[model samples]
Every structure is written in C-alpha cells, then in structure tokens.
Target: MAHPSLTETTARVQEIIGSDAITRIFRDAMSRTLRDAFVHSDGEEVFVLTGDIPAMWLRDSAAQVRPYLPLAADDPGVADLLVSLVRRQVRAILLDPYANAFNARPDGAGHAGDETQMHPGVWERKYEVDSLCFPLQLAHQVWRITGRTDHLDAEFARAADLIITTWQVEQDHAERSPYRFQRHDGPPTDTLTDGGNGSPVGRTGMTWSGFRPSDDACVLNYNVPGNLFAIHVLGNLAELATVVLDDPALASRARDLAAELAAGVREWGIVTHPVHGRIYAYEVDGLGGAVLMDDANMPSLLSLPLTGGDAIDAEIYRNTRAFVLSPDNPTYTRGTHAVGLGSPHTPPDHVWPIALAVQGLTTDDDAEKRRILDLLARTHADTFRMHESFHVDDPATFTREWFSWADSMFCELVLDVCGAGVQSTLDEEQVPTP
Candidate 1:
C-alpha cells in the first residue's frame, strides 16, 4: 500500500514539475518501480526483485527502496517498510555473505547448475563486492535520514561482522579463500578463469570479486571500482559500529580494512593514459596489468563521483571522465537516438539509462544536467519507465522492460530536475552510495 504522505508528496512534486505529461510519467514510474515491485513476506520482511525476475538482489533491492528513505520520516508506514527491507537484507547476508542475490523462499530458486555451493535460498552465487556494499549503504542512509537505529538489532550486528570477515578473507583470496565458481556452456564473460577462481590478483590489499556489477566475470580479480565502493561502504559500517552498535572492536576492524584498501587503490589502481593523463582503471592485477574500459553499471569507473566515495573534481576522476565518455572506452557508444555508456552484458550499441542519470547527478554544470535530462525524457520508449538498456539507434527496442532499479534511478533523476518539495530534505550526502 502506498503511504498517504508519499501520495501527498507526489502531488507536490507534480506541481513543481508543472508539466502534466511529465508529472504523469513520474507518478507512473513510482508506481511501477517502487510500489509494485515490493513484496511483503510472512516474516515481517520485504522482498524486492529487479522486475521480471523472481529473486532479490542485494544491490538492486537496496537501490529500489532508496528513493523512499527521505519520505520515511514523513510516513510511519514508509519507515516500517524500509526497516523491514533492511532486516530482510540482513537475513539474506546471514544466509550466505558471498551470495549476491536470494530467493524470497527456499525453493531452489536460481542457478542450480553453477559450479559453486548452492543453497536453497540463493538466486545466484556470483560474488560481486558491490552486493555487500549496497545493503550497508542503504541501512546507513535510512539511519542518517530518519534519526533512527531500530534496524540495528543483534541480527544486523552479526551480518556486519560476517561482511567484514568475508571481505578480509577475499583480500587474501590467493592463499586463504576457498570460494570458486564456474558455469558450463556459457559465454566467456559468464564464467571465471583459472578453473572457476577468477584471474590472478597477486593478493593486492583490495578484496577480490568473482564478478563485476555487470554479472560478467572479471578479467582481473581486483576490480578497482568495486574496491573504491568498498572504501565508501567500510566507512559507513565503521560509523554504524561506533555510533549504533557501540562496538569499538568492530569499528576499529572496519577502519583498518578501509585504510588498507584505500592505500592499495592509491598505489596500484591509477594508470597513466597516453592521452588522458592519470586515469582510474576498471580492473587491475597487482602484477602490473589493468583493464582500461568502464561499464555503465553502478560501481563502474564512470560512476565514482555519483557513488559518493570520490570527489567529482578530483584530478584522476576528471581524467577518467575524459576517457570513459569519449571514444577511448570500448563500452562508450553513440548513435542516432542517444550517446552514453553500455556494458559487456548487453547487446552492442545499447546505452544504459542509469549511467546517463549518474552523469547528470555528478556534473556541476546546469546545462549539462539539463541535456542529460532531455536525453532521458526522450528515450523512455514511450513507456515512462526506464529499461535495463536501450538501443542507441532506436529507443523502442530496449532490454529488460520491467527492471525496477533503472526505473527507481530514473525517478530520482526526475525528482532532481523537477526540484520536488520532498526532495528538498534529501541531502546529497544521504543519496545511495551504490
């Protein structure tokens, strides 16, 4: 059920937009993305799927609910829903800290054939680092905006400890970790190298991920964008430990790990581009090799500033922006309909709407922000809901028509451009780090 306050706020936002057509689109997107995708389970839990899929992703679930955090304070029902979702995520983490997605019920839900330990509740055991980071980011934002820590129960504390432990083990994956994954009869990008263990990382201080945010296996184990996201999430966990959990030992552990990863990124993640000067790499092996391209995913190199760990004007980030948005990056594409970033997981010449929104959110220039908004407004395929990725040549032919994460992101972008009244309370710092 939609909260009364949420409905009231939507009306105010429509007034601010001052366009009946755009306001109707925004309202439709909110209903489709935020309201329709939420499921109230039997155990005081909320399960959110990425849409057209029957499982919940830790990253996608968090992003789907994030636009409602600011409104949580105005509506008790909204706060309850957000808190319940946080609790559900904690339960999912306890089920398998390494698993990126989960089933609402244990019915052998996802990827039964993958060469990894399969649990009944696991949707897919592709171990992406951003999966762990996003839940913490959402939990932190809920507490920050609502001035409440009711979500920090004993289960949450246990989940936080498990997350930190898993990250530490992944930091030494070459010798200490036992996790490996393989998928048969799939594309090369769908499976890992070195017999299901990913490519060699040389044990850099940054943690290892079996997959990228795109659900494609990493060519190099230490994904730089994932590590940068870790740095931000670890800081969020540290604050939660000290202020909410009152666990100094856990806080110290998080701080120490964050420092080590930050140092590793500074030492090895930046490379000298012949044309763009110093730029951040997408993936790096400690043994002096790096992938230079960026994906259009949330944890991609181009999303660093929007993801909130790095400053927008930082020298390396500027250089990286120059590289990622230009012809240099393989995934950067241009066509008659649009020009933006894409990913290896999608068809050629397709651009992601989330990436376009991230570019607008991160840019300080009003004209550039407006331009990106215009692009988004034009490329919704007349559905008023964002897709996973749309064709650069034709907006009508897009991928993943029911993806709620993209729709939620588009809703956020609309609120920003329309200057919604409720959005006035939404501090930039309170935005989802994912």
Candidate 2:
C-alpha cells in the first residue's frame, strides 16, 4: 500500500492545525521522524525502527505512532500506516512478551551478548514493563479512535494473556519469576547487581520491571510509575478482552489483577515528603525504601496523567508534580535554554523535550503551556525537528539526532495548543473519499 507523499500528509496536517508558522513546525517535525523511521514491507507487515537505530522497541514503536491515531480516521495514508504498525507490534509481542525490542526480521542483528534469553528476532531482551504496556496502549487508542479492531486477532489475544501472566509472576518475582539480565561491558546502570536479577523487592503487589523506560536497570525492582501504568493498561486489557475478544474470564482476571496492583501502589507507593506532603516515588520496594526522584521519561512521576494512570489534579499527583519539577528533585535541571527533568541515560544537564511537552499537556495554565511551547519551538536547534535532549544551557548541542518518539510527542503538544481536536479534521464531510 502506497502512503500519501510527504507533501500531501503535511498539507493535511497544516489544514488541520490552521496556523501557518505552527503548521510549518509540525510539518517539518513530523516529516523528519515519521518519514524516516517507518517502513512497510511487501508483505502485510510494517516496521518502525527507533531513530538512528535499525531496531524496533515495543515501547518506542507504540509511542512513535500515537500522534497519528486520531488522524488515522481521516487520512487513509495515516490510517494504513498506523494499522500496519499495530499488526507488526502484535506479532512482536506474540513472539516474546519478555523481550523489549526486536529486529525487523528473524535475523541475528542486535545486542547478541547481554544475555537473559536470546531470540533471533529480538534486538534486546531487557524486560521493561512499559515495553509490554505500550502495545496495549497503542492498540486501545487505535480501536477507540478509528473503531478498527481487525488487528485484534487471535494472536493479539494470546499476547494480552501472556502480558497478564507475566505480571502475575512478577508480583512474586523473587520466588516465581525466571527473568534475569546482565551486560558485561557498559555503564553501571546498564548491568544489574546480584548477578542478573535487579534489586530486591518485597512483593509490593506491583509487578517488577527489570529495566526502566530508559533501558537502565532499576535501583528498586517495582517501578512505581510502571506499576501505575500497568494498572491503567490492565484495565484497558480487561475492556479489550470483554468487548473485543468476548472473554469474560480473561477480563475478570485483568480487572482483579489491576485492582490488586492498585491496592499495593496505594499502600507502598506514596511517601510523605517533608516539603511536598504525600507524593509518588519513582521506584519503591514493598519494604520501606523509596527513590524520591523523577526521570524525563514517560511513566515518570510527572506523567501520571499522560499515561491515563491518574488525574493531574489529584491531590497526591499535584504534590508529586511540585516535587518532580522543582530543583529539589536531583534530576530536575535548570539551564539557559530550558528548565525540566533529565535522565541518567543521557548526558548530564540535558533536558528532554518529551518531559517538557508532557508538562504542557498536563498543565491547565495557558501561560505555562505557552512558555513550554516557546521553549520547545526555540530549541529545535535550527533543524526544525526535535532531538532526544538538548544541553540545558545550549539548545543546539543535543543528543540522538533523529528520535521519533520525542518528535511525535512534540506534534501532540502542538495539536493540543492549536485547538485541533483529535478527530475534528476527520468529520464526515471533511474526510477525503477515494
């Protein structure tokens, strides 16, 4: 299936956004990452490699195409691309739910040595919980917005069951789980201590993730945000099971598991900071310890609302927000170009556009949102495309020259600010008929 040329897609986006300068920014940003990262095979498969790397991360592939879902209902080209990507993601998950990233084909292509379990199709086997959650999130979005469920076939149902089972095992990770990972040569964060299993957790009801969304090993196995996200997407899975798959038993299990996880989170996830009152921790154990810092990634404490886990206005969330965005949080950085959060995965003093856009998306303050937009618009470093992270003091000096997830998120922020309702452009009369 041939997609619309870049020109046509840009024109459609521009027509929807309705702001000349902002549309130009969106067009340039979307064109670079979306056009470069995605590819469709001669078969009924599609693949989306992470920017500058020829591998598809389950987490990234889901996020990189999210901004297109609402638009898919209107644009056949966008719709086809997203639908194909959904099919590809379902195949990857069915291949291995424990594997976070995969090669385009069953060829020995990536990270062949850092061993937990190796598959020819898998690029890296590091088990980040968000990697599993993201495919469900994307599938849910595609179904809700486009009303297309053909992609939700038998294999997709099997993958959903696998995810629930994995989470159930990880709930008792120390005893029941078999996943382990070790990287001989890399940064300290890349390798887990205690041989391959990550730091110990005390069965906090939350599922264990061996790695963070940054692909860095977790200091505490039960990542608070990831568990929160699991609850949200598990609910999504429950609905999908009942409505799409028509399996009430599977739906009941998902709902019960989500409720158990949420109960655990409420018990151990919230900490009373002296300055911030009750707030969410980045990572926690069922024991007493908690990491009171946030990274500049989705599923961070700052992104609860964005992930559909919690409302931004919830009291504890507001408290967490203040702590996450303030200088008191060790990862929060203030530079000449921007003031936002950074991650250990990148260099010091670099701010992620993803964090900034998420802030704008979750905030109700118009002025604050505009301020974030101005910072994002000005920091594209003359390329008119978003980068992974820019130097806190110097926007031009950035990392990851081509990152589609960040680019897609920036496009989402643009759509929000420009008052472009998600499906507004796809109204019956406005949609082009072939």
Candidate 3:
C-alpha cells in the first residue's frame, strides 16, 4: 500500500535512474548505488559494500537501510527488511560483547581480524564505544522515521546496559577496564604499543577510550569530541531508559554518566587557543596533555550537530573548526577542485565524504550547503556513488565503493538541498532532554 506521493516519487526515481541523460545522472547514480548496497541477501542485512567485502556492520549496516526507513511505513517490502536489519544488529551485539563489526555466520569468507571487512554474523573484535552508540541512534531514529518501534525489545535494554557498564568501567582504564587490540597492518605508528595493545592511561574522571572515533589509537585518553558525543548520547539514553523503557535505575545511571562527561569536558577538554582565545582539543589526557588536531571522522568537532547533539559554543569548537579546516590541522587539506577535512587512514590530501557532509549538515549557511552539494556531485567521480575518501586532487582515485553510510549522507545532502525535506516520524517523538 504505497502512499500516492511515494508511488509518484518512486516512479520519478525510476525514470531518472533509467534516463541515460546527463542532466539526471546524479539521481541515477544514487539509484543504482542504492540498489547495489541496500539489497539484502537471504533475509539478512544489506551488505555495506559490494566486491569482496560482503557483510554488515553495526554502524554501516544501520546507516545503509536508514534512508528507506521513512518509506517503510507505507511500503511493506521496506518495512520487513528494516526489521530484519535490526534483528541482525541486535544478534551481532549479542554475538560477542566487544565486537564492533559482525558477519551472518562463523565460516564467513572475510578475514577474521580485518576491521574493515564484514563476515556475516561474525563481529570483528574492535572495542569502540562508537560501534555500540550508533545502533541506539539508528534504532531510535528508525522508529521515529517510520512510526515503527517493533525493533525496540528486551535485547535493546540489555545492549543499552552493556554500553553503560562498559563506559563506566572504562572511565578508569588502569584496572577497571579489560579491553585490548593489536592491528598488524598500516604502519608502526598506526599500530598500537605495549604488545600492539595500548599502554594504560592514568585514571581520569573521564572514561578511557582505547581508540578514537576514527578507530585509530588515542594519544590522549579523553577524546574530547567523543566525550562531547557521550554527553549528548548518554543524555538521550537517560531519557530512553526512563520514558521509552520505564526503568528508573537505568535512567539514573545514564544521567550520572551524562553529567559526569559534560563536567569532564568543561574541566578538562578545553584548552587555550592563542588566536581564537580558547578551544577544545581533539583529545585530552586529563592530566594536561592534549592533542590539538581534528580528524575527518564523525563525533568530530565538525559533526557535533550532525550527530543530533547540542551545539558546543565553547571557543575551542570554533578554534578547532578553524584549525580543522585549515592546513594547520594535520588531516585538513586543500586542492584545486575542493578543500575540506581529510584523514590519516587514507592517502595524504584525500577528502572524506563523511567529513564534507558533516560540515554541510552543521553549517547554517544555505550557500555553504549548496557548495558542498556541488562538490559532492563533482567529487563522486561521476559514478554518483560516494567513496570513503578521494584524492583531494582527483575524484576517481578513491576508496571503499560500498560504503552505505556515505551514500546515505549524500542522500541527506540532496534532501537538504530541497529544504532537507526528509523527516522521520521519529523526530516528532523526541522525548526532550529532562
């Protein structure tokens, strides 16, 4: 029972995708990519990418199917599929407590330890708080976007508790937390120490993150941006605990942690910015050590608002914004075609689509948004498919063809162009910060 408007919209989408004309290329590009990336096999989650990589990620898989969530309310086909993806992610979280990515089965074709590959039902063991955090955001959003809360169940409560306990223990990395990892690729610097595992950081009031949101090792324990996000998410979790699930104890726990993370950010995350007066650092040691640069990752300074969090008016966000957009930030780069956030994971001067969209998402200027849209249109290398990162100079030489998150973010950008018309019924269900 497709709504008349959606029926019309789908037809238009099909026509635009089928038309081999240049004017409608972007629309077609998005359509073909969506078909390739969002289609699930054997009643499973959509593969976040194509090629040799074939599996779902807690983060990427949620992102892949998210765009179609609003359509599911009227389209039964999409609704059933969305529910399946949630079940897959819930099963993945339950599969192994510490894993960030998962597969559909144990004998999955992908390598066991590769952080990037997906083995169906087999979660690659990476202890990133972001991994757990994304599912909650996506699950809540899916319900909101489609008026479907069928996915929120007993398992969600347990997963939420696991996240809380993990964070609480990790706040004191010395003896309280029990997490470790060792990557064998990249460079020696990219690899962690103390037997490829990170050395313990001195206990700070803030929770210890073994890795930054980038999945790279944290030089300073309190990743300020992540702490900011923790405040935002933990605040949301506090409400979800009380209002959504009606558990006073869990709500209280979320509140305590939310308040603590905010306090920690204020007391420890801020640093003196000689030019901008004061700014937040990328990471802080709590004992005075701070890494004063930004990465091209979400939960990044630029992505604060994009993650559905409150704005940090602190001078440090402004300062860090300036630094991140400038050549001063190690990861920032400028090129002939475009200038934006880059990352260490990719080649030098490679711009990330996630970073670009975040900037567009957080920017208040319509002109800036349009500019980003055009760059993205041009930067997709005419494939209309978003890549993880592209050479700042050449758009074709990119990485990660099947990144559904980037594609969804690009769709979000297109929606933004038309007044960001994509609304989730879930947004109206916001419980409000108490």
Q: Which model scores highest in TM-score? A: 1
Candidate 1 vs candidate 2: the lDDT winner is 1
Candidate order (lDDT) = 1, 2, 3
- In model 2, the clashing pairs are none
Evaluate all candidate structures by whole-model CA lDDT and list the values in order. 0.83, 0.81, 0.66
How close to the true structure is residue 186 of candidate 2, measured as C-alpha lDDT? 85
- Candidate 1 stretches greater than 4 Å from native: 308-313, 420-434
Task: For residues 24-130, write the lDDT of model 1, one tens digit per residue.
Answer: 66678777655578887565588887899989999888878766766786678888888888999999999998898899899997898999988999989999999
TM-score preference between candidates 2 and 3, better one: 2
Two-way TM-score contest, 1 vs 3, winner: 1
- Across residues 137-167, which tens digit of lDDT does each residue of candidate 3 receive? 7666665556565676788778777778878
The C-alpha local distance difference test score for the whole of candidate 1 amounts to 0.83
Clashes of 3: 14
Per-residue lDDT of model 2, residues 222-257, tens digit only = 888898888898888887887888888889988999
The better-scoring model by TM-score among 1 and 2 is 1
Predict model 2's lDDT versus the native. Answer: 0.81
